[model samples]
Target: MKLVVQVKLLPTPAQAAALATTLRACNAAAQYTSRVAFERNVKSRNELQKLCYREIKDRFGLSAQPAVRVVKKVVDAYTALHAGIRAGYLGGERSRRRVKAESKPIAFNTSSAQPFDDRCLSWRYDAGTVSIWTTAGRLKGIGFVGSADQLATLRAHRRGESDLLFRDGGWFLIATCEVPEPEVFEPADWIGVDRGITNLATTSDADNFQGRRLQRYRRWHGRKRVELQAKRTKSAKRRLKARARKEARHAACVNHSIAKDIVAVAQRTGRGIALEELRGIRDRVRLNRHQRAIMSSWPFHQLERHITYKARRAGVPVLLVDARYTSQMCPRCKHTTRSNRPTRDTFSCRLCGLAGPADVVAAVNVRDRARRAWVLVNAPVPMAA
Candidate 1:
C-alpha cells in the first residue's frame, strides 16, 4: 500500500529563492515540451524525450534530472488526455491544450534523489533535520516536523518518490511511503452503507448520518459565491475563487469524517462494508433542475474513496455492488418496482406492504447483494482449456 506523508519544511531564505528559481526553470522546460508535443502530433513519451531532451537542457540551463522530469510532466498531461479519451469522457482525437509555465509544485523522481531509494522517497533524516535534492542543488539541513504517528511511519516504512510543494507561503516535502498490506479480513458479516445527497450515509443497522449541517453550510457559501461572481469585480472574483477552493476543502473534510465513522462502525462490528457502485450515475440518471443541482454537489465518489482506503488500512474488506433497484426493491418480499418507493425517505412495498426508511432499506439490500458477490468471488472456478 502506498501512503503519502506530508512533512512541513523549514528552508533558509537563500534555499527558498533557489528552489523557486528551479521550479520556474523546470516549468518553462515542461511548457516548451508540451507545446512541441502538441504541435508535432507527438504521443509517445520516448518520442517526446528525443525531441526535447537536449534542447531543453541547453535552452533552460537545467540539469539532466530536472530536464527529464520536465518531459515527464508534459507526458503526464497527454497521458491524462488519452485516459479521458479511452474512458469516453472527452470528445477529441487529441488534446490541443498547452501547458503554461508557472511556479507550481514539482515532482522529483528517484534519479534526481540519487541517495534516497527505498520503498519511499529517500531522505537523509537526522534528528529533525532532513536533506533533499532540488533542481538548484542538494539542500541540506532543512528542518521538517511531523506528528508522532507520522514520524513513526517515516522511521518504519520505505519512502518512494517525493514532491516539492509550495503552498500557503510554505515549502513542504510530500513523501510517498510504501506500507505493507494488511491481512485481508474474511468477513462473516457485512455492513451495508447507502450514500445519498440529503443523508450522507445510512448503514444497514439503521444509522442515518445526515449532512443537513453541511448542506446549510454549502448553501450559504453558494449564495455568497453567486453574489460575488455576478459582480465580476477583481476583488469579488478573487474572493469567489478562494471561496470555491475553501468550499471544496470543506466538503472533502466532511467526507473524510463520514467515511471514518462508517468504517469505524464496520470495524467495531467485525464486519466488512458494502457500498453501491454508482459509476457514471450522473450520466446514467436524468433529473430535474433542482435534482441536478443536488447531484452535482454530491460528494459520493469522494466518500467512497475515503471509505476504501480507510477500510483497507484497517483490514476491513469493502465490496461495491450494483445499485440497480436497490432503493425500490423490497427487502421483505423481493418485489422490484418503482412504485415500491412512492416518496423520498419512505419505502413501502406494494406487494408485501413492508415499510421503513428508504435509505436503510437500500443499505440492507446493498449488504445482501454484496454478500452474494463475496460468495461468488470466493466460489470455485472450473478450469478452462
Candidate 2:
C-alpha cells in the first residue's frame, strides 16, 4: 500500500527565501510550459521537454531534473484537464462550464507544489534534515520534524518523488512511502458501517459516531463566514480561508479517529468491514435547502477512504455492498419499501414488524449483503459440466 507522510520544514531565513524563490520559479516555468503546450497543442512530456527545456533552464535557473519535472507537471495538468472533460465533470460539451474550461490553458498557482526526484532532493532521516536543490543553490542541513511513527515510516518505506509545498506560511514535504501489506486472514464475521450526514457513522454493532458537535461547529463557522463576507475586506477573506482550513482539518481528524477505532475492532475480532457502495450519492438522494448545505460539505467519501486505508493497513478485508434501499429494508423479513422507514431515524417494517434505528438497520443490511457476497465469492467450484 502506498501512503504519504508529511513533515514540516524548519529552515533559516536564508534557506526559506531560497525555497520560496525555487517554488515561484518552478511554478512560473510550469505556467510558461503550459502556454507553450497550449499554443503547439502538444501534451506529451518528451515533446514539451524538447520545446521548453532549454528556455526553462536559462530563464528559471532550474537544473536538469527540476526542468524535466516542470515540463512533466505541465503535461500532467493537461492530461488531468482532458480526463475531467471526458468524465463530464465540467458538464456537457455545450455547457458554459465545459466551454470555459476548454477555452483556456490550465494555470498553476504561484505557490503550487513542485515535485522533486532523488536527484534534486535527499533525506537525512537520522539527523532529521534534508538537502534540496534550489534556484539559488543546493540548500543543505534544512531541519525537518514529524511524528515518531511518520519519521519511522519515512526511514523504512519512503520511495519515489516528494512534493514541496508552501501552505499557511509554512513549508512541508509530502513523502511517498510504499508499505508492504500483510496477508489478509479469513474473517469470522463482518462489521457493517452506514454513513450519514446526521449520525456520521452507525455500525451494525449499534455503535454510533454522532455528528451533532461537528454540525454545531460548522454552523458557527458558517455564521462567521457570512459575517466576514459582508465585511468584504482583505483581512476578512484571509480569516475566512483560515477558518475553512481549520474546519477541514477538524473533520479529517474526526474521520481518522473513527476509522482507526473501527479498523482496530475489526482486526481484533477477525472480521471484515462492509460499507455501502455510495458512488454518486449526492445525485441519488434529494435534500432540502438546509440539508443540501450539510450534504455539500459532507466528508462521507473521505471517511470511507480512511476506513479502507486503515483496514488495508491492518490486513482486514473491506467490501462495498449495494446501497439501494438499505435504509428502508427489513433486515429480518427481507421486505423492502419506502414506507419501511416512517421517519428519518426510525425504521419499522410494516410486514415483519421489525424495528430499529434507521442507520443501524442500514448497517445490518450492509453486513448481511457482505455475508452472502463473501459466501458466493469463496464458494467452492462445482464439478465441471
Candidate 3:
C-alpha cells in the first residue's frame, strides 16, 4: 500500500515571500476562473490557471524568487485538472473554478497546492538532496519524507493533492497519497461510531474519543493570537511567528494522534467498524458559532477516512451508517422519542425508562445500522489490498 509522508518544508525567507505572492496569485487565478465560468455571456473561454501564473510573474515574479519544485506544485493542479477534463471527467472541469466565498486571497499564511505525477516525479524525492527548477533558481534539500514511488490511484491530483497551508505561525504540507488495493478481512468483532456536536465522538466500546484537547489548545492559542494581534511593534509580529509554529506542530500532532487512536481501536476489536453519516449531523445540529466551527472542524470525516485506509492496511471491514434518530433512539428498548434525549449527554427513554450516556446510545444505534447495511446492501466492497 502507498503511504505519503509529508515532511515539513523549511523554506528560506525569500522562498516564504514568494510563496505568499504565489498564494495571492492563485486566489486571483481561481477567482478569475470562477467568474469566467459563471458569467452568462462570456464565451471566450479563459484559462485563468495559466493566466494567474503568468500574470503574477509579470506583477511580482522576482528573478531571484525561488520557484523550486515546491511552488510548481501549484501549477501542477491546473495541469492535472486539464488532463482529467481531457480524459472525459466533467467534474474536474467544475472544480477548476469552484471559488467559495471564504476563499480569501492567498496570503503569507496560506498554503499552496501542487499536483504530482510521473512527469513531476523528477523533484518529488531525488535522494536526500531535494532540488527543483524554479523561476528564481534551484532550491535544494528543503525537506522530504519517504521514497518517491506513488501508486497510480493516488497519483490522481484533482484538488490540492499537495496542500500547503500557513497557520499558527508555521507552514504545513499535507500530501495526498493513495494506498495500494485494500486488504479484505473476516472481522472478529463489530464496532459502531457516533459523532456528535457536544462530545465530538463516542464509540460502541464506551471509548470517548472527543476533541477536548484540541478545543482547549485552540482556546489558549486563540488568546495568544489575540495578544499578538493587539501589538503594533515589529518584535510582537516576530513573536506571533513563534506562536504559529507551535500551533502547527500541535495541530498535526493532534490529528495524527486522533487518527491513530481511531485506527487502533478498530484493529484491536478485529471486527468490522461503522460510523454514522456526518452529512446529516450538521443539518440536525443547532450550534452556536464556536460550536459550529468546532463541530465542523472535528475532523470526523478525516477520522473516517483514516479508519478506512488503516483498516485496509490491517485487513478489516469499514462500514458507514445513516445517523438519523441515532441519538434519540434507545439502544436497549428500541424506543424512539425526542424526549429521550433532552440534554447534552443524557438519553432517557420515557416508555422503557432506559437511561444512558447520549453519545454511547447513539453509537450503539449507528452500529446496528451498519450491521443491517452490511447484511442486506449490495454496495461494492472496496477491493482487497
Candidate 4:
C-alpha cells in the first residue's frame, strides 16, 4: 500500500522565499508542458511527446533533467486519464478540462531503501535531513527542516515504491510498502454498519457509534470560519489559517478514530462489516446551513478508506451492500415500506408488527443483505463459457 505522509515544515523566512521560487518554477514547467500537450493532442501525432520535449528543451536552452521530469509529469497525467477511460470512468485531460499535475514530483528506485519501503520514503527523510535530489541539487533552507525527526532512521525495503512531492504548498513523502500476510486470521464474519446524519454509524448488533461527535466539531469550525471570512483583516486571516489547520486535524482524528473502532469491532466479532448505501447524501441533506456545512466537510471517503486499510492488515474484509431499502425493510417480516418508518427514528412495521429505532432496523437489514450477497456470490450460474 502506498501511504502519502505529509509532515509539517517550519521553514525560515529566507528558505520560504527560495521554496516559493521553486514552486513558481514548477508552475512554469507545468504550464509549459500543459500548453504543449494541449497543442500536440490537437495535432495528429500526440505520441511523439518525448521527441517534442527534447526539441523544446534544446530550443529553450533548458536542462534535460527538469525538462524530462516535466514531460514525465504530463505523461503520467495521460496515463491516469487512459486508465480512467478503460474503467468506464471520466478522468484525465478530457474535453476542455485538463488539470495538470502541478505538484513537483521526483521518483526514486527502491534498491536504495529496501525492506522498510512500505511506511516511509527513505529519500524524503535522508539521514535525519531532507536529502531530496531534485533537478536543482539539494533543496536548501526550510526544506531540510521540513521532515519530522529529520528522517534519521529512514529506510526503504526491496519491494517498495517511493515518490517525493511538494504540493499544497507543502512537502510530502509518499511511501508504498508491502504488508505481510497474516498466518492465522479471517475476515469472513458479518456485522452491519448504519450511517446516519445524527450518528455517523450504528451496528446491527445493537452497538451504537454516534456521529454526533463529528457534527459537534464541524459546527464549531463552521461558525469560526464564517466569522473569520467576514473580518478580512490581516490578523483575522492569520487566525483563520490556524483555525483551519486545527479543524482539519480534528476531523482527521474523528474519522480515523471512527474507522479504527469499526475495524476493532469487526475483529472482535470475527465478522465482516456491512455498511448502508447512502444515496445522494451530498445533495439530499436536510440539515441547517451550519449542520449541512459540517456534514459536507466530514471525510466520508477517507473514513471508508481507513476502514479498508486497517481491515486488510487485520485480515478483515469490508462488504458494500446496496442499501436501497434497508431502512424501510422490516427485519422481522422482510417487508420494505416507507410507511413502516412513520417517524424519522421509529420503524413500526405494519405488516409484521415489528418496531424499533429506524437506524437499528436499518442496521439489521444491512447485515441481512450480506447473506443475500453471499448467495449471489456462491450460487451456481448458467454455464455460458
Which prediction has the highest lDDT against the true structure?
A: 2
TM-score of each: 0.83, 0.95, 0.61, 0.68
- lDDT per residue as tens, model 1, 1-385: 8887878878789988876776666667777787788778787888989999999989988767667666776787777766765765644445442222111223332222221223222466656876655566777777888888787787788465566777546777767768887887789789999999889999999988899988999999989988998898999987886788889999999998888998888888789999999998988898998777788989999999999999988899999999889999998789999999999889999998999999999999999998889999999999999
Who is ahead in TM-score, 1 or 4?
1
Which structure is stronger by TM-score: 2 or 4? 2
Q: Give me the runs in candidate 1 sitting further than 4 Å from their true place.
A: 44-47, 92-122, 133-137, 233-235, 337-339, 350-353, 380-385
* lDDT comparing candidate 3 with the true structure: 0.60
Candidate 4 has its poorest 10 consecutive residues by lDDT at 108-117
Give the lowest summed-lDDT range of ten residues in model 2: 285-294
lDDT of each: 0.80, 0.94, 0.60, 0.61
RMSD of 1: 4.9
Candidates sorted on TM-score, descending: 2, 1, 4, 3
Report RMSD for candidate 4. Answer: 7.1
Superposed Cα RMSD, model 2: 1.7
Cα deviation at 238, candidate 4, in Å, is: 9.3
Clashes of 2: 0
Which candidate has the highest TM-score of all? Answer: 2
